[model samples]
Target: MMSGEVVHTFGFTVYFVFALMFTWASHIQRTNPGAGWWALSISSAFFARLLYFALLYTGDTRLIITAYAFFIVLEKPLMLTGIVRFLNLPITTRWFWFIAALADLWLAIAWVGEFDGFTRIAGYSLINTSLLACAAWLIFRHHKVVPGLSLRIAALACLALAAHWLTAPVFIQLYPAWATTGFAVGTMLTLVQYLSLLTAVLSLFQKRLLESEARALDMAFLDPLTGLNNQRYMTTLFDQALLLATRPHHIVAIFYIDLDNFKPVNDKAGHAVGDEVLKAMAQRLKDCTRSTDICARVGGDEFVVIGTQFTREFQVEEMARKLLEHVLLPIEVGGYTFQLGASIGVSLYPEHGNSLTELVQCADKAMYHIKRNGKSGVAVYGGETAGGLGLREA
Candidate 1:
């Protein structure tokens, strides 16, 4: 069997390594308060163990022992605080002070009563057990919100550490010969807890990084003013839809919409009101199209709608009519009511051209046909133009 001195040396060495690792992590993740608190917790544990080990060689003095006890009691509260802060949980300052006071009172009672080493160990174990259990409970409760395998593993390690501490006193009382073995087991459990927590922290960092990247991609591809897909993204969608439309009967309709009298809204009502009018128009375009369709704001007063999986020409014509009707609806923004109209030109796949550039050009020509004949109408490529029922000014 190994001596108590050997076990203490090994445990303190492990604590020292973990403390350095946590300190480095805290520095790297300076924004995370939980990581800083965790560093402090491990550092406190290392200090307590180092002081105890030093006293073994030097004479054990009351002041030194009290300092060691103070650090030992301080470690668990710091760990609990780290867990609470890391998970972004709400905790009262008063509760933190209350826990710290309770721990201090227990340490004082043990010191003043001149408790034996075994009694001190048992009392401190119970307190540490309660704290570890609380930490485990908090992690488990929030596991769903912050999902990761590492988090669950960390919670389980905390629970196991709590159970080890809770049972240590009983095992030590019944089998004094196995006291060193109990200490060894505790050191192993502490090691597991530390590693698991480190992994959990890394997992959370990775999650944040992935979410940030996704948001960045959205900002790059989305239109800032209308919250619609931009021209570049729309082109990408058009290519993908072309690949899916392999059947000879499948028709993809590209509608190129040019707003009538939109510039006057910007000039008369101010750009702010014109922006609101554009947003309302974009929403109407979205409502008229199916989920499979792609709608985008391609220019200042121009939009594109791509409809896929259409088996007949009339379906495309019907969709074009719906879009023009919806765009012609009255828009009320900032207490000012405005009526707008649209001239939409449509071109079909295979008949117009294979590529997006070809289809858009064909659609644009068809739209100009409507503008020349009369405003507010839908025109089909290689076909006749339908004029608006009622034409209105800006």
Candidate 2:
């Protein structure tokens, strides 16, 4: 075979590979019909391109190129849709594909030689330009929602296809061989794009798995009702906090928060409603906390919040103030609102205790003092006096 034939032959073969791959992918998506639709649509478009090229390079006839130009153009937008749908990226509809198909049919059939060549060029240019503009719009709209890797790879592929389509007129002049060479390069480009998509898909799956595992771990160590770390987990957290606190410039605060009037909800509305109220309260506590803070439920209506990266005592106090307010507010559920409040006691590192047990004991004592002082407040453990421990308002 001539070199040109070789160039064109593999070009057709590459398209065939894409066609079969898309078809097989769709077929195997028996459980996922949505994905199957996407695959079939993409495969059809690739099949069209393959058939067009298959005829052109083998027979060396204007008939194939002339007859299939519209088919080729029509396939472009469908190609995009396939990728978008495959990635589960959002799209409104097939409007772009419809418009492209119409434009392609008109251009392929209507263009005459010489006199109309410029118009043909302009026609295809406008249509292809619209396709590119649409692709860009899709990318921009989804940039924030799409993952970084997926965005980079998909966007590059779209832009490449657009470039290839737009340069049709000029490519003929630069090197009459440019088209054949582009075919070979394009095959490699397709392979790279496929690999990238595969990477993105794998990343997505791995991300989901990590999230699931994290949730499972959380459930194992978290009190779902109060959204606080369970006793075992909180103890571990306390030890970790203490270790972190030993470092220079690292300060940690341990707080034991006890709810006031919590038993009333369980008594009046029953445990089910009480459970709902508890869940709501826990969510509020979570909302009030920073990401680095560890909040845990150590007992019934008893919770703890550990603050890391704390440098000053005031930070702990401010946090207590926020927590107090968070728990004091009325929670509304099922058209009924209920008022509840919490008492909090804080103990700082080095001062409260050198050990986790000492710190927790000190904070617990301070919490009792707050309860005795009539609740809805914060108390901090002061230094030990000659007789006993000291509790101060925070």
Candidate 3:
């Protein structure tokens, strides 16, 4: 069995180490809102342990006990609140504060007057276990959505911590002599729980890091204004679509679209309204395309659609019509209604050209044909016409 002072000092050291580690992690990852809450949780635990040691060896019983009461009431809730924040789940912090205040009031009134009773100890155990169990349930409920190994391990650790707290009261009641000894059941369980908790905290940090990296990758490939895949992503998709058009009669069609009268909207209203119109157009394009199709904003007011998995060639023309119907929908921005139009140039594999660049160039010329003749129309490239052979008015 360890000596009382040794066990207390060791536990304090562990808590302090984790507190600092969590604080540092939170500082570095300050962009994540949950990291701040997690840092507060671990820091609260450290202070609670510090007060426990002061009660044992240094401070006045009443003053130390009062400070402990306040700290203990805050500790478990802070930890649970951190878990809720980390999961991006909702929690009623007002209720937590109310309950903590009640617990503090009880401790001030009942436990501060006498230091020899087990009732206060039992109450503390029940309160701590309940809070821990609530946090464990919250974590476990998200397992289906999150399903990461770190998340699973953290949920299990929370359950173990809850169990340790719940069982502590029983041990205190059954073995009074041992409960008063150097290596009490409560102290041993707390040490184990803290070690498991440290592991859980590390897991949470790992998950956050992975999520941050994924968001960065997405931002790289996505257009912020239109929320569509950017040119770089579209190029990769274009190549994949070309490869998929391997079987006979399987065709890949490219539609190069340019919005008509878009600059006038920006000049008349403002850049903000122009941005809204772009977003609206992006959604319309997505709505018109098939799930297998890739629609991207390759440049300002310019979009591309890659149509694939089509056995019939005429389906490409129908897709072009649908795109016009959707993109021409009435858009309302800043209380002003506007109607936008598009000119599209179409190019098909094996008929227009085999390569992406040739297809794009053919489509560009066809689109310019529509723009030069009359805006708000679709033009298809074909031989003899070379630039554009077919036109459909919008």
Candidate 4:
């Protein structure tokens, strides 16, 4: 083998072996789908590049270069496709993928007859234009779905690859003396850039995995539907609130809210719309409470708010009014709006009970009374209230 051929073989073999190993690791990155696609797409580029170099080095100039050139054009398209899917493209547009794959095959076949570089140029134009369009659509339109750091790094790498190939014709014109140096420099720079990208992708994935694990751990004590602390979390938050209530100066008020007709919303809307409504309602509920007060989804369409350090019951009373106003607002689904009402029960800590269990029970019973009387009103625990008839257990 020629010295040039040996160098090409060595370089490409190293590149592809690394890429091959990365493929396995990328497949396992289910947590960060963006990183997975970024890795796989980049690995594809290296795999194609390795084969291209190997073919060129062995002097398989006719068929191999033809195949390699077709592959080179396919690279950007494939990479953008992966990125688009990762960033959450509408699944209904799967037709685009079929079209892209067909373009690759057509280009591969169009190069077979060697009818000049015209067909290759045409093929390259199709692939390049499509890739640019896809990339632009992904970055601009789907910005919300993609994480910031990964997007910037990945977009740079893709742009770099596209720019590198766009300027390949200029380099192809190098004089014999300048050719080797120019090619070596270009190759080394390209390798270093892509290698850096690979490492960045790996780092991004590791960080994502850690965050996912943390979220998973948090979810273990969280209610997924309402994005609230679960029963387990309630126990913990209550205990902490309990300690705060022990001081003679401190008072905590618990407001328990139950939906009047929430079952029909879920039953009719299907789980997806129900989920959306729950998430929407959750945001509204959180907005009504102070940050110092803890609000949690205690059950299906049931939420509990613990208001602490509020000087008077009227402060909690005002909060309850705002909570009702927000929850009563219409939630839209498929261009149609529906309303859900709330039944609120209020109980004060230390006054209601000294323990977490008793406080919750009192609040829960007070909530049931509001529901039993008429589902749209609030009930406060105390002899000063006219609606002591509204409380079942206070």
Instruction: Using lDDT, give the best candidate's number.
Output: 1
lDDT of 3 by residue, 1-394 (tens): 6665666567667767767766665676443445556667656766766777768766465566456556766877776676667666766766666666677766766665674545655566667667777777886787543434545555666677678766655775687555445234444544454444455555666667899898997898888888888888887778788777888889999899999989989998999999999999999899888888898888889999988987886788888888887888889999878898999999888788987788888888778888998788888876444553554433
Q: Please give the range of 10 consecutive residues that has the lowest summed lDDT in model 2.
A: 29-38
lDDT of candidate 1 over 1-394, digit per residue (tens) = 8887798799889988888877787787444677788888888878887787788666664555566667866888888888888888887535654675776787689788987766766776777788788878988888764566766777888899899878877887789878679778877877887887887777777777898898998888888889899998998899888865788799999999999989889988999999999999999999888888899999998999999989998988889888988988888898888888888988989887989998998898888878887879988888433752222111
Instruction: Write down the TM-score of every candidate.
Output: 0.85, 0.57, 0.64, 0.51
Task: Kindly provide the TM-score of model 2 when superposed on the true structure, using C-alpha atoms.
Answer: 0.57
Q: For each candidate in the order shown, give its overall lDDT on alpha carbons.
A: 0.81, 0.68, 0.73, 0.64
How does model 4 fare in lDDT? Answer: 0.64
How many clashing pairs per prediction, in order? Answer: 0, 1, 0, 0
Give lDDT tens digits, candidate 2, residues 1-394: 2354575556556555655654454464232233344344345445545666567656734455545555556655765574566455656657877877777666655544422543554566567666755665565456444366664765576567667667755775566656566556655555554445444444555666788899999898988776678978987777777666777867788888898998988888788888888888778878988877888878878888888877777888888899899898898865668899888888988876777778888899889888887988899899789976677797
